[model samples]
Target: MKHLKKKKKLLTNDTFVIVPFYNEGKVLINVIKKLKNSFKNIICVDDGSNNKNQIGKHKLGVFLIKHPINLGQGAALQTGINYAIKKKAKTIVTFDADGQHSAKDAIEMIKLLKKNDLDLVQGSRFYKKQNNNIPFIRKLILRVATIIANFFDNTQFTDTHNGLRVFNLNFAKKINIKNNRMSHPHDINKLVSKYNFKFSEYPTNIKYTHYSLSKGQKNLNAINILFDILISQLIKK
Candidate 1:
């Protein structure tokens, strides 16, 4: 009875949801509210946003960590991860603040992690039943990016850049993100390959709204990210 109660408690608590945001306005609050329904601990890492007032109002049951300067998503995620570790979070979930990711997916991923006794569960938009709303150009870019990441990282991943992920503390302690920007996804993949963590992909839903699309990465930026990864690889070589 005690073990069952503890297991149920672990599912409801002992999980921290890390949300890294730049300039997301009220969308972030809504995301937090939705996540609160399933998760008790929520960490919001503000990566030096100009509009700080938007998230400043919500503090109940949420940890808001502010970066003095814009360090990028990787840095923000690292900050949140470190905080969660200090809090002794049994499981850590990385979620996007643009309102594109689904909180239900996150909950499901966490449950999958505990149930399967896996180290990590990555969300994939193209894994099973694909989301048709993905912009054709964006989908092409992601497909190309996944191929490149797989070839270099020597691992098969359906979606290389999906933000929704859940991992246990063992994997969390092994993570050290060097790249602080867009190239961080590649860095994470490299780490996963290097450490050989027990992981799997879960089909997730991506809600693409006009606002999210506007905030999405541009074609030129994608090119720059590729260039950045190429240079980083060269430097390592």
Candidate 2:
């Protein structure tokens, strides 16, 4: 008699996707729907949006968490991460609430993370030669930021501000993003450097629509993020 072998379980089943948003209008719903097609555990953290109706009604299998007042993206993401950790998620993904990130790319990143036994896998719009349709000023800002981050952290990364990332419970438990605002990326980079986390960059697709661009960070805000990080570092010293 021949015995049958059991098939491997789907990666999406044990993974949790965290989406942090503030006043995201109708695009948030569409983003959640797209993620739902691939991810079973979805956590949407609304950072005190005045219009609670913006996300509309929550769908089945999706968890919604709200803040009393508007915190920042970092705070919202931390909230979602805490919830997912409490639920015993095997993996966690941080995704932008704007309609720019692709669910397909996230799935691929998760696969790479598991296959290589990596702690974190970050999505890079400029990882390889591809058409991300990035605006000129935004591209310049990211390039400069990447250079500065690499100089200080001694790490190599093509894009510093991309919000798409996948990681396992080890990273989720070890990282604590305190910057609470646009500077959280800097905080993440600092943690990665300090802990020497095993990480890789994956080429991901970014669809920059007018709506997404409008919702993105302003060009000048990059300066403020730098200032915030510098001040935080000074305070630490």
Candidate 3:
């Protein structure tokens, strides 16, 4: 009981940074360390990682949760959300584990959420202006996705697939991520309308590293996501 209490006290954080990772051992610990500077409560959901031992070894004030198998990124994120809610977290931020996202963007997003008393804040790579370093193919994917997403929701966001988002506890309760894969982006964007969350997208400087670029979705994956959406719609019938 004493040990559990100590762990809880040490792990308790007002700002919970929830990260869903799958075979990202190379960058997971580093990502947590970077967030440690800005956030106190950190939760890393291991999505059936082969390196479960590896993640367990890193005790940097992170509450590590493990999935028995590779469910999906969306599942991992949802698991983290559940844990964060149970812990009574005041704020929750979803961060990418591949390190494509910037900690500065997360800090600014959370700050804006608190200052403006907004329920949700999303990141946009193309908001304001985009960097030339963005690959042409990657840029095209985001643009097309953004266009399709715009048709689904009234939210005027320049980037639709961005993973960096901050949610207040109240707003987080309203968010129920059902997608078990990358389709989570669409699932979340569509929910804003249903809940009427006071949401807005802010400019975030995204850094596409070689590793992230290599691990990123392909054009073929886009077709699969479209198919998935269509199937989901059909299922609703």
Candidate 4:
């Protein structure tokens, strides 16, 4: 608690937030609203949504960037990060547009990043929190996925797929999220391991509302995510 105060004093200023959404209209707005209270600079990237309605239209003090065609979440994040870098942002945050993520947790993640002078801070919902609300099948999939990630990537994180993260410009500039969709998280881990970036995985909480759960990755989709990662690496080779 005391440490958070010290970190927040420095991090709350000039912090850039990147929110990527695809057709998450109203939920995106509310989530951004909550974030505005925590940071001054916020950017929302519309990831080529098919919906006719626009997002953050009347929301003041928020930067809105949109892609013409549907790109993956990774591309949307890259777009926002590029803009933040151009604007001379020292630190940037990647947040999910869905209501699953909490602004309070984001504050802590950013603070820890600055407090430890780390390159990246990742939020892990499974760190210490009970997965009571998590569906049984979902819980099994995530735990297995975490084990696989740690085994192969050599990362010791408890949660691998949480969308909340903080990165200093040095690391942010080095990021290239080519996987685009759900596979982006895996690609980011590869980059982190490859670059040997200073990072931490902190315990965080998530709200598994029906809406958020519905938008979440299906259990069967893990197979597809694995295939995509393999194919991308194969292409690089």
- List the pairs of residues colliding in candidate 3: none
* Separate clash counts for every candidate: 0, 0, 0, 0
Candidate 2 Cα lDDT to native: 0.83
Residues 1-237 of candidate 1 have per-residue lDDT tens digits of: 975664456456578999999988888889888887667889999999987546556765788899999999989999999999999988999999989999778877887998999998989989986865998988989889889888888889999888889999998998887778877778776767899888989999999999888886775677877887787888974
Question: What is the TM-score (0 to 1) of candidate 4?
Answer: 0.90
Q: Estimate each model's TM-score.
A: 0.92, 0.92, 0.90, 0.90
53-142: candidate 3 lDDT, tens digit per residue: 455576687888989999988889899988999999888889998888888788778778988988889988888786737888778887
For model 2, the run of ten residues with the poorest summed lDDT: 1-10
lDDT of each: 0.85, 0.83, 0.79, 0.81
The alpha-carbon RMSD values of the candidates against the true structure, listed in the order shown, are 2.8, 3.5, 5.4, 2.6
Q: What's the ranking of the predictions by TM-score, best on top?
A: 1, 2, 4, 3
TM-score of model 3 vs. true structure: 0.90
Give the poorly placed runs of model 3, Cα more than 4 Å off: 1-12
Model 2 residue 172 lDDT score: 87
For model 1, name the residue pairs that clash.
none
- Tell me the deviation in Å of residue 125 in model 1: 0.8
Which window of ten consecutive residues has the lowest lDDT sum in model 1? Answer: 3-12
lDDT ranking of the models: 1, 2, 4, 3
